[model samples]
Target chain A: MPVLYGSYRSRATRNLWLAGEIGLELELRQVWQAYRLDKPDAPDAPFNTRSRGFLSLSPMGAIPVLVDGDLVLAESLAINLYLARRYGGDLGPRDEAENALMTQWTLFAATAMEGPGLAIQNVHTYGRADSEAGRGEIADKVEALGRPLRVLEGHLGRDGHMVGGRFTVADINVAEILRYAQSHEPLLAEYPAVDGWLRACQARPAFRAMWDRRAAEPMWL
Target chain B: MPVLYGSYRSRATRNLWLAGEIGLELELRQVWQAYRLDKPDAPDAPFNTRSRGFLSLSPMGAIPVLVDGDLVLAESLAINLYLARRYGGDLGPRDEAENALMTQWTLFAATAMEGPGLAIQNVHTYGRADSEAGRGEIADKVEALGRPLRVLEGHLGRDGHMVGGRFTVADINVAEILRYAQSHEPLLAEYPAVDGWLRACQARPAFRAMWDRRAAEPMWL
Candidate 1:
């Protein structure tokens, strides 16, 4: 079994979601972010990204590191990509072209959407929406996000999925990244296709299972 | 031959570098960013990102779109990974584990380093370093970049390569992203191992060939 280090509230949620989809069991070791804990440096505190053990696994101190056999991987999306390609039946790429296409969509989500999505998510999650400056930042981030969202909206209009005309890891990765902005209902409403596609993706039993576990986990931030 | 869109001046330069390494000949098409043109709306304007043909290829209007056979893939790193997997002998992943590791490094470069690297590069290239505000922005970006660079420095300190203890697409992808910040000598000097690794990567004859082509290209920014 693969050893996954991170709490469900962390980026590890996506990996768990994919694991649920494939029924691949992972030895999940809960790790938190130091900034999220009140007493992260305390000796009794749980293993976190700042912990020496976790740092040795990934120097960047990122969550969602997957240790499958000898292959230790980081980055939530990258982990999912590897998992899907390795253990996922039809959930993975079926050919070289599909592999390239899936990689393209994954990178697109990471580079083009994740930043603005996180910014927008932070504004809502951290109570920044109550402040004028925070609201202004959200507006700016939403505008910055419009271009890529429009592209996704256009692509989703066809076949209603990211790649292979089916729900592969591509859809899961992109949908999760886009989920950061899901709180802004009005923004998502602007793209009906994207809205519908995202809903379908989240409606999956695996995603619901993951979300339930995530909601049950303690959120420090 | 694969049809590669974008000029030698665009992100296509990296793909060209990888192609030089693997001896894969691609049909290079000259496409510029509309923002780079003096009068983008002019009918006589060259085929650029805004052109219907280019947009049809990639709706995001991104350059460096690769059309290998039937695969129309965006993202420079994704294209290189595909090319390397298909044609690169030792330059590509030899197995699934190597594939996952390479993908992780590529995403790390894209999501972690590219933003600050580009910020620092723009500050230098656009002559923003002449002003206090620009210099401050450069300093801030350099600081933001240090964490990921430190991780990379530690990794490169291992076997002088990204994965498999040899140069692969991982090295190419990371080296290209780091090249954006290479103009800042003082910043790179802090990570001696990173600096040494990047130097060796750039010193390759394939990179030199690509650099020569890029130098001869017209610049708008």
Candidate 2:
């Protein structure tokens, strides 16, 4: 079994969700972000990004490093992609074209949507939406996100899913990023196709299982 | 031959460089970014990102859309990965683990480095570094970039290449992003491993061929 180091509350949720979809068992090791701890370097502190042992596994000190035999992979989307291709059956790409399409969507989610999506999600998650400044930031981020959401809406309208008209790693990767912004009901409501697609993605039993586990973890945000 | 849309100066350069390495002939179509035009939607405007035809190719209105047969792929890194797998010999991943490694590195480049790297590059390219404020911004971005560069330095030091001990699409993808920040000589000097590896990548004849063509294009920046 692959060893996954990071809390479910982190981006590691994406990996755990995908693993659930494929029924792949991962050795989940709990690692927290240093910011969450009062003394990250304390002798008795839990394994965190600042931990020397964790840094050896991932020099960047980010979360959700997957250690599979000799290969150590970081980045939630990349890990999910690798696991899907290596272990997933129908959940992975079926052909070279499907692989390329899956990759395109994953990259799109990372580069195009992740930044603004996360920002919008943060506004709600951190209870910043109550402040005027936070509302202004949310407005700007939502505007910035419109084009990508429109693109996604068009794609989903045409093909029904990210690729192969089936829920693959592409959907898992893309959905995880969009989930950050899913809290902004008004924003998501504008794009009905995207709204519908996201609902369907989250409705899966695997995603529910991952969400439940994540909810049980301590809420830092 | 795959049909590649975008100018040599755009992210398409990454794909073109890899194509040069493997001697793959791509049907190059020049589509400039909309911002370069005075009136992007003018009937007489060149086929730019705002052009209806180009938008049809890429809904995001971004450049460097690759059409290989029935597949329409966007995102430069994703396109390079696909082309490498489809046409590249040893330039592509040799196995499942190598594929995962390459994907991991590519995602790392996209998520971790591209934002600050491009910001620093723009500061230099747009001649903003002459101002005190621009210098401060550059310094901040350079600081933000150090950790990721250090991580990369460690990887390059260990493996000498991204995967399978050879030049692959991963090298091409990462080298191009770092190229944006390469103009800041002193910053790169801090990490000798990264600097040397980047130098070796650009030294390749294929990269040289691509660079020459890019240089011939109209300098917009």
Candidate 3:
């Protein structure tokens, strides 16, 4: 059985969404966010990703560390790609070209989408969600989002999936990042195709199951 | 022949370096930095990454856009990973476990090292390598670099490679990111193991060939 360290509230949601898509039974080791470092940590709160033990497993201290037998993977996106490839399902890319597409979109999500999207999410959820600072942050995130969204707008509808038609981990990987825009209605309004594609992806039963599970579980302390 | 757009001066160096290692014949379409949008046309000025043609192939207008057969890919790390896996020699990961390590380091390079290292590079090359701002940026990048370098200090040197006990594109993918620190003497000195690993990897003939090829070309305008 594979164990994924870090809570759903963290980027681990990316992997949870993949596990749902692949139907993998993952032992989720919920982890505290790094912000917890400022406050006193509970003696034994599930598992702190900041702890020495977890850091030993994942030196980056960022979470969704997946332990599959002998292999240990840290990055959430990397873990998803690995699971998709190892499980040998429809989740993985079909060929070299498709695999290239997979890498392309995954890196795009990481570099282009994830940073700004998370900034928006963090501002909205914890920081000033609608204050001047928050609005400024949202605007910056939205502006940062445009270049990549236009890129997606160009290539996305090539059979309603990112690569080789139909859904693959590429879809799940990229969609999860863009899903951050859902909370910012105006941002979503700007990119209709992105909005449509993200909606289509989120509507999938796998995504619904994962979202519902995330809603029910209090993974973050 | 796979054609890689964008020049060695851009992140395309990562992919070009990989091509050199894999012995893949990549038709190099040397591209210019996007910031050159302010400059006038030099009829035959190396194609700028920001050009409409490049963006049509890559929505983000970044490079190098790799064209192999029917597939096109952008994002430097992604292009390298795709090439490594597709043109499998020792360049790619050997098994499921090794694949996970490959993904881990690549993402680490992207998320952890690349941004700060590049920020430091920008400050050093363009901003102020010795100014207060330069010192601050260097401090920030060095601080940002500590975790990942510590991690590499732990995992690297399994018989002189990142994964599977030998040199792979994972080495090329990651070492290339860490290579940015070479210019910052003190930063490089702090992490001796990282410095050692980077030097060992850089000393390879493949890296030498790519570096030489890059030096001989006048891609920047």
Candidate 4:
């Protein structure tokens, strides 16, 4: 059985969606269900740097680790790629060219969009809005993020999906990152194509199921 | 023919190295051969992006972008993985478990190491020694980087290489990032295993060939 260890609201959502898309049997292990980062005595408390299981799986002490038999993988994007490739079908691309494009978009999401998108989350979720310095810094980052989002908007205008004509790991990874932007910026009014693309992605039954599961949870920093 | 457009010294080095590793037929296009970033007529001068070719592939502008026929890919790690998977050989681990570990380390190098490693580069290559504020900031970032370095040191201590017992894409990606750390900090002196691994990676004939080519080029950035 492939076991995914992480919280519902975490990057693990990408893995769960990928598993559903690939029809892989995945056991979702909610590592943070009991222990919030603020709490210490919960069963899920062993998710910090001091936790042996986390340290064993991820030296960086991050979340959303995939354990398939003896294969243990960290990094949500990489895990999605690995699962899609290994499963091999609609979840993966049909050929090399498509796969290359898939890799390109997935990485674009990770490197270009992740930094600014995470900043949006950090500022809105944690930063002091009253502090001029904090707000100014985050505002700058949010502004910088507009460039990448515009790029995505242009790409979506050309093609309905991120890579190929249909969905793949690229869609899963990029959509997951942009989900942050949708809630924070709601600049969806400017990019109709991108908005439509996001809605199409979210309309997937698997994604809807995942979102519903987390609907009751409090949004956290 | 797979034509790679960028200078050897830039992130294009990774693509060049990957081409060599996979034995791909590569034509290295020298876009800024006669001009430097500081030169008035340099193609990248107005925006001060890395390379014109890189900018052409990604409007936001970065290197190195890999072009194969109609398929163009950016992001060094993503390009390497695409090449490895498509070319069909063991530039990476063959075992499923080992391959996941390879991806794990590759992401670790990208997310954790690259930020501070690049900061160290900026300080060494661009910062003024007389600027106390600049030096203090660099010192703080460099110290913060020690935690990740310690993790790398521990990993190298236990395992001979990053992912598998032998070389892989993980090593290539990580070794390149660590190379930036080599000149700024006496990293080798602190971690013997990391030092040996890096030396081994650099000593590869393909790596040496690429290094020689880069060494002969004038500084652009």
Tens digit of lDDT per residue, candidate 2, span B35-148? 777787889988899888888778878989999999999999999999999999899988888888889889988888899989998999889988998999989989988888
Best by DockQ: 1
**DockQ for each candidate?**
0.86, 0.84, 0.75, 0.57
**What ranking of all candidate models by lDDT puts the best one first?**
2, 1, 3, 4
Residue B215 displacement (Å), model 1: 0.7
lDDT tens string, model 1, A145-200? 89998999899997688889989999999999999988777888789999999999
RMSD of each: 1.2, 1.6, 2.4, 3.5
Query: Candidate 1: deviation at residue A21, Å?
Result: 0.7
Which ten contiguous residues of candidate 2 chain A have the minimum total lDDT?
A212-221
TM-score of every prediction relative to native = 0.98, 0.97, 0.92, 0.87
Model 4 residue-pair collision total: 0
Q: lDDT of each model, Cα atoms only?
A: 0.90, 0.90, 0.78, 0.74
Q: Candidate 3 residues B1-221, lDDT tens each?
A: 88988876677888877777778888987677767545625555546766667767766777778888777777788888788877857779777688778888888788778788888777867859879878987888889888887778767633457888887888888888877766787776666666788888888887888899778866435
TM-score of chain B of each: 0.97, 0.97, 0.91, 0.83
TM-score of 2: 0.97
DockQ of 3: 0.75
Interface RMSD of each: 0.8, 1.0, 1.4, 2.2
TM-score head-to-head 1 vs 2, winner: 1
